[model samples]
Target: MSDEVHTEAHGQVAEPQEKLDPEVRARREAALKLVRKYGDPVLRSRALEIDRFDDALVDEVRRMGRLMHDAYGIGLAATQVGVMHRVLVYRTELEGSVAALVNPVLEWSSKDKESSEEGCLSLPGVSVEVERPVHVRVRALDERGQPILVEASGLEARVIQHEMDHLDGVLILDKTSRDQRKQAMRALREALEPRPAAA
Candidate 1:
């Protein structure tokens, strides 16, 4: 199963992704948010499927979107925000905005795959190569609880697969080779280290 994980993703490649909508981005900036970094116990946990689609669920999705934008991340997962629920928000390139999905299930993936660089909000600065299906079909519920089926390829395909992996406690480090994982670990360690206070 791990062998199927891909390296290339939809957005924020080796650089930070800029917010598309200024008004929306301004509102998002006003929202205080936090993203769970590497070594956080929450990031290691498998998210629970969201069964109840109520106001609380809606709030959660909105909050996730705020955090994703705040972190300049194209994609974010429930686990990344310290919520162990199978939910995620990603900025759609076509729509130029974020979309929230709950309990996403990958129904199909193409045999042809590609490899590319991916960075996670949870992992901070480390970007590793990932190989993923160029095309995929997923079934999920919108934040408002409407059923939706997404057929995506290229970047969108990569975004869905990447966020879905997080729901299962899978990180880019887990999907990479041993050497890449080592580099990721070392970077994480450095990020965790205490820095000298400025005078």
Candidate 2:
């Protein structure tokens, strides 16, 4: 595959830094290509293994991290941007603390479950109530490719699991009850419809 980065919106890299350095600009421009949807075949397919954290891969990870932040999304997966790699970026807080996970694995989950509203960029405006573990522990590579284990409970844990599911080609719709899926789909359709021009 080509090493080119994909982007949705044109121009400027989505860097958290104030100045758009060359690297940052490149990453920002590349990320636009990643803002695709669940219907895309890539989203449904399995992700690729992350062997080593090299330059290009590192750049992509950073770009993805910044893009997720720029998009105001709490979490994002590599598949969300057309890469079939098991990588994800997320922020649990708006104050800029972030988490970048590569080849993440959910090591353990709580028996307890909770219902929460979940949505995805690929799924667009469709949001659904889904049941998920209240606590989860995951092992993943940090941005530098170092192994890191994270144990989270409550909302933070829920967000991690939700994004991790995207890595495995699982959407909330797939887990939701059929009736709920149908309702969410209807709402999505309505939201997507083009509005009539003003009279």
The regions of model 2 sitting more than 4 angstroms off are 1-34, 192-199
Which residue pairs show collisions in model 1?
6-130, 6-131, 6-132, 7-130, 7-131, 8-116, 8-130
lDDT for model 2 comes to 0.70
- In candidate 1, which residue ranges exceed 4 Å CA deviation? 1-33
lDDT against the true structure, each candidate: 0.73, 0.70
**Could you estimate the TM-score for every candidate?**
0.83, 0.78
Give one digit per residue, the lDDT tens place, for model 1 in 1-199.
1111123343333233363367655654343236777888887789998778899989988877766655456788888778888998886542258888788999999999988777776775576788999999999999888999999888778888888998888888877789988997898788768889999
- Per-residue lDDT of model 2, residues 1-199, tens digit only: 0011112221112234356567755664455446876457887787887887789888988878777765546677888888888888876654457678888899999999987666666665576667888889999997678999999986678668877887888877887889989987887677656789999
Task: Choose the strongest candidate by lDDT.
Answer: 1
